[model samples]
Target: MARPVWSGALTFGLVTLPVQMFTATESHTVHFHQLQRGTSDRVRNKRVNERTGDEVPLDEIVKGFDAGDEYVVVEPGELEDIAPGRSKALEITGFVDLEQVEPIFFDKTYYLGPKGKEYAKVYALMEKAMAHTGKAGIATFVMRNHQYLVAVKAEAGLLTLHTLHWADEIRDPRKEIGDLPAEAAVTDRELKMAEQLVETLSIDWKPEEFHDTFQEQVAKLIEAKRTGETVEKAEPPAASTNVVDLMEALRASVDRAKSPKDRRGQKAGGAAKTAARSTARSKRPSKASSFDSLTKAELYERATEAGIPGRSSMSREDLIEALRGARGRRRADAS
Candidate 1:
């Protein structure tokens, strides 16, 4: 089991439950080391005194506040002395309906687990109560020397903590973004078509359906470089032109979304299958775009649906080829 990132007691009024927090999500972004171009030498960063041009040791570093024509140097120890006490507890200040909280206020999320078997009953009670009432416990706590505002809600029989930005942290969009259109009237026909287009494309939320295509491409590029293979560049997608007619765009979108897939037969002749494939690509009816435009996960799903053998071990290119082959077979059989 993974170790908990934070362990603290959660308290509200007279009730207290010892719990541990674990990060609920993780990023899969590819990281690259800084290096000189065309060379293997790594570039390193150092903290140096601007005036003296000398490297500074970690122990010698001190934060300073800029005052008028001077500075107020402060030591790490001084900051620690005045820092918010780490009480090792998430003290709930209030309980409010979850709907009252805006999504923009939420930041990171953590899974809350009972610290021990003895605490499970109390934890379950709190979780059930919150879930039943559709309320979240708003709390403030200090962790890693930083104070955070968080909302605790029950989900899937477990407590989930969502850290939120303080009220002052959110910027007013009107102040930051200038000259926003106040209103643009839409014709009833256009509105109806747009709503229909939305309805046609909407699907139940399935996070597994999405994948980070850019990261997969980066991994593929790295693998190609390691194997001394030539990397092929994909053509950029055509830039979208401004929509002259809202109704026309909405109608086209709805049509594309509703288009049925072409059925070629598994036993069809090679020439017939090739023509079918060409026709399919030409239509590009919302789903027949090239492999480059799709995520690795999307390609994997296609491979799975096609019943491609050994797809689990295949690379992106291999998956694409396997899917194409499967489509050809299906087309031939249908014919």
Candidate 2:
């Protein structure tokens, strides 16, 4: 079981529900320690007194603010003592429609659960009420001596607390971005073509189907280096669309998006297989013909049927090669 990061009382109106907050997400990115070049020695950081040229113990450290001529030091305990509600209370000021909160303001998320089994009913009631009304409770609480503006939202039968950035923290993009296009005129034909392209490429949001390919490549690079093997370089980014041929590019994009292969890639379950099969049937010259004519989706279905290993991660060319190898081995066994 995961440990809760915080234990507090949630307050709204006359009700008080004891809850525990657990971190909702964690990073899986590969991390590396700093090392000196041409040596295996790890480069570590240490806190040292500048004037004395000696290491300083953590206990001796204090938060300091420079006030032009001098430094104002503050103790850790002093901040905790001054924290709102002594950092134990999460009080909801009001509830608002979830859509009213801009996505830009949201930050980290924490799963909020009933602290004790006895408080389950109260927790469920609050979650269900908020979920039914599509509302989020706007709250303020102090945690780890820092006050946070948060939204308590109901998600999948549980409450989730999202920390938010204060209004002053958000930068004005209009002031920051100098090259933003100012009301550029878009031709009606180009707009229609672009809309058509979007419609053809639109897909239902299935987060599971997407992944961090760059991270995967990074892992592959590490493994390849360890094993003295070569890793394939990733494809270069696409060239910027030519302004002179905007309509032509849009039309071509729409055509490509409408292709059965691209359409099948977006679909899932039986629909994907059906589309792949249909494409194969329409494109395949003969049963004995080469797999070059088949799309990656069709090759993947064939690979799945054959139980070829690593088919999920393989490219279209890789799939075709694997399928051919599988067929050759099957023929050899039969003979």
Candidate 3:
């Protein structure tokens, strides 16, 4: 079970409900420790005094702000003293239509649950009410000595709190971004073609079908290095479409999207040609050279043809090994 990060009372219009907050998301990215060059020793950071060149203790460290000439120092205990009641309470100012809140304002999310089983009814009632009305409660609270603007909404039969950026934190894109094109830059014909392309490529949202291919490649690279093997480098990015060929590019993209089977057939044809070449070369008494010359995609195609289980998850080397094992099994059956 996950432990709650905070426990507090949620107040709204004279009603108080005890609740707990838990982080809603976690990261899975691979992490590496900093090390000294040409050595396995780990590199670490420490707070040190500039003039004396001595390592500073945590208890002695205080927050400082640079003024004109000197520094203004503040103690950590002073911050807590000022936020006396905010740490223990989450007060909802008002409810607003959920759709009114722009996605740009949202930051982190946390799950809000009843502090005890006794307060389950109140929690459920709030969640159901907000879910039905399509409203979110705008709230403010202090956590870890930082104040956060937040929105509490009902999601998947539970209340979720999302931290929001303060109004001043948002930047004006017009002032921040340069060289943005005007609407008049696009021709009517190009706009229609672009719309058509979008329509042709539209599909229902299915997040499960997508994954982090870059992370998968990183894992494969690590495994390959550990096993003293080389992993294939990724293909280079395609050249940018020229403005003169914009219409032609849009037309070609629409045509390709309209006929997905044609694209699949092209890939299948390439794989079939590779297989045929391999078979023809096998009779020349050079069997070892056949699979080694094929690319990873070609090997994957052959694995697919052989109906190898778990081939989709296999690396290029794994696919080659599996294909070899399959070929040997077939030869044994034939004999």
Q: Could you report the Cα RMSD, in angstroms, for every candidate shown?
A: 7.2, 7.4, 7.2
What digit string (tens of lDDT, one per residue) describes model 1 on residues 1-335? 87898888899999999999999999999999999999999999999999999999999998889998999998867765665545387999899998899999999999999999999899999999999999999998877667899999999999999999999999999888898767877788888888887886566665664566567778889999999987666436545756575555665455445433323323444785457546745654355567767656557656654555565556667678877888788889999
Considering only N, C-alpha and C atoms within 3 Å, which residue pairs clash in candidate 2? Answer: none
Model with the higher TM-score, candidate 1 or 2? 2
TM-score of 2: 0.80
Query: TM-scores of the models, in the given order?
Result: 0.78, 0.80, 0.78
Sorted on lDDT, best first, the list reads 2, 3, 1
TM-score of model number 1: 0.78
Q: All models: lDDT?
A: 0.79, 0.84, 0.82
Could you tell me how far off, in angstroms, the CA of residue 11 lies in candidate 1 after the best superposition? 0.5
Best by lDDT: 2
Winning model by TM-score: 2
Weakest 10 consecutive residues of candidate 1 by summed lDDT: 259-268
Candidate 3, position 57, lDDT: 100
